[model samples]
Target: MNKLLKTISVSVLGAAMLSPVLSTVVFAATAASEQQATRNLVQQLSNIKSFSANFEQTTKATAGTKPAQRTGLSAQHMNQTFVGEMKVERPGKFYWETKTPAKQTIVTSGKTVWIYDPDLQQAVRQTLDDQVANTPALLLSGNTAQIMQAYRVAQPDQSKTYYRLYPRVKDSAFQSLTISFGTNKAPNMMVLLDSLGQTTSIRFNNVKVNPSIPASVFNFTPPKGTDIINQ
Candidate 1:
């Protein structure tokens, strides 16, 4: 459970150099532009009522960073990949199922979240409060105002639709988050960098925006004989 939680916190949540001797006026102008860009990004995310996508997630150590060792696998083999499906609805509801590398399902119904591991026949239930809602995992389904307050958004290239968000809080789960949008202005990819120097990249495929999703999709019930832990 500890391992799973760590993965969720780092891989799920998760930027930049500046020119020296830049003028104060230039700096002010840049800050104003970034603020506007942040608002625009927030609006784009707010417009999403429902989202569903097939995703490929890859995790690797940063260059020059030592990779953590795992049983039967050397540090050089630390890179891991997983394919998954994700669904989200506005106001705190989402479903994430990892299909390969390992099978795990995480679903939340506004008020509560459930993490299920089929192999272990275990399910962990957690309350979905403000703290949990602030995580990057729930970014699409969380409060936009809170998001705006928590991160400083920057769009390095106005020509491109990708935005990088730096956490305002020092103890944030990850170091930074980069979200990329397609030509249609739909999110297509996300990259998360953790403090431990691990990078997790998630690319979305067959993305659906504001689609009609059944409410049941956000609710999960452990099967018979499954051990349940509440947190």
Candidate 2:
């Protein structure tokens, strides 16, 4: 279950460990304008120093067999939703805590990243740069060239609110990513398609941008008796 939760968290970073999803997917010349628009969007998001939001995360796995031919629902292809809260600050700080389906917290200060699972009584620690090195979430603190180098951006629809990002690297964790912005020009939703075609979708509500956040929120200390693993 801890492993599953870890995967869930990673999936949310979009192409990284689950809510941050935008990376290198280079496009053809025909998509020049759309690509430019994507850069513009990134520039806007980069200006935000802090962000908080309520999120509903749904993970849809692939079926082992064709459901159409199967008599019963396949657990392999089951869909699950988890409710959570997300907080982000510039220069590589983030916090995510799940309140339902299980209780877990993933926090990254500027220096270290911690993934804590209360039910398992364990926490994993690693350097922040290594954990988020190639993830889409790194875009929050990265430059436009970094984003453009990894992904090709395009707006598939007439609605400027939606943007599609495809990985230029063939070996990316997810196949593609799509992020939707609300009227306030803040990201309200993000969906990632993994290599296996499974989709991880997250919806953000009650989003507050550039709000002040306490420094302690990014720090974590394993509780008494909790096992700590350094990665």
Candidate 3:
């Protein structure tokens, strides 16, 4: 996998599966009140047992290393979009299918994650634990206290529905994340900014919260001729 795809497999899939495969431990890095607010937000998210949505994802890659140069490069690649659909269930189950720009499916059964690309005729498998660990806001499955330990949460707009998170872990893949919740208290969109200065924003449409999602959707059997790459 190239740098972009590798980053996507972690952030995109991880954010999309936040209600499931997340188990984190964070510290209190922000104000006590802010911590409490983040906890409240996470608590609301944790209450969702299942969800489904049609999505539109846009990724922008910024060039150059210096901040000024990156700012200029960001404008040139800010409009690329990919459309998809996703379903997630708590305690380790998720299914995501990207239909435009590329065709792919990613599924996880809490224990393992599978990434399949039909065009490439390849299926890659990795432990679900590792993938979720590096994904921001994945603290929903963990205790609220842990969320404070891992991220510095800020509600820049002071709206109960929007939050921006900065990861405390040095090895984390993304630099920061912003999440917005729908009136139903389920995630409506997530924006992830990675170390490479690439930003991926996913917006959800036709969202269904606490819907019935079957266990079968999280399991995948590679086709007879597909190459299986175990990680």
Candidate 4:
């Protein structure tokens, strides 16, 4: 997986939303329908008992080159058993683990949100909201309040009923964000374009509504002797 995803603290992955297999793949909807559906799903997210899903992602599309592919698995419960895991085979094979409220991330070979390279030599730290925006977890988790607070939600082009997200705070990290509904009922995919026009796309699959998972999934304890640092 891309080491960068682990940065979402949702990599510990950035998440929220329904899965492709779960989503019906909506072709188009009336403007009002799109708006209402987006709003409805946003509300449904908060009420859903528990959720789980799998997804595929590709970062940096290059001409004549196959994009790096990744598989993501995530699950969240009412009390925050938020768990998202992503595996990417690229420059190398890597994994991302996240726990919320704190929304922490641990990366490969000594890098992370919880553990930084210059990370005071192996201590864990907390990530701020700006850092939080970079995660796929936030998108997948479907925390509309958090999403609405951080991004100015809009529909840029009327041709397609896609919901676009603009970072309200205005930072150098990303240029624009857009997410699409699979069947005008459930969220299926997210496309994030950074300042460089380089894009990261995540598609949700195998969604399990009202899942029967446990809260322990969201909790983590670092290896013994691993340093601890709090932001």
TM-score of each: 0.82, 0.75, 0.75, 0.53
Q: What is the lDDT of residue 75 in candidate 4?
A: 20
Candidate 3 structure, TM-score to reference: 0.75
Instruction: Superpose all Cα atoms of candidate 1 onto the true structure and report the RMSD in Å to 1 decimal.
Output: 6.6
Q: Give lDDT tens digits, candidate 1, residues 1-231.
A: 222222321221112325576633322223227778887788788778888999877766778775343322335435777788999998788898988888989899899989899999999998887667766667878778888898888876655667878889898767888888886567888887767676667788999998999998997989999999999
* The candidate that achieves the highest lDDT relative to the unseen native structure: 1
Q: Each prediction's Cα RMSD?
A: 6.6, 10.0, 11.0, 12.7
Q: Write the residue-wise lDDT of candidate 2 on 1-231 in tens digits.
A: 222222222222222133345555543333237656676667667667788899887766555635453322234424767788888887678788988877888887777778899999999887755325446544444445566677777765432556677878888766677777777666788776666545567788999988899989988999999999988
Candidate 4 positional error at 180, Å = 2.3
Question: What are the per-residue Cα lDDT tens digits for candidate 4 across 1-231?
Answer: 122342120111222456678974444433434455456446644554345555554455324433232122222211232344433221111234433323334442212234433223455555434454345434444345666566655543444435666666665455566666544334466676654334666666665554555433343456666677776
Task: Highest TM-score: give the candidate number.
Answer: 1
Question: Candidate 4: lDDT over CA atoms?
Answer: 0.45
lDDT of 1 at 88: 90
Which model is ahead, 1 or 3, in terms of lDDT?
A: 1
Q: How much is 212 displaced in model 3, in angstroms?
A: 0.2
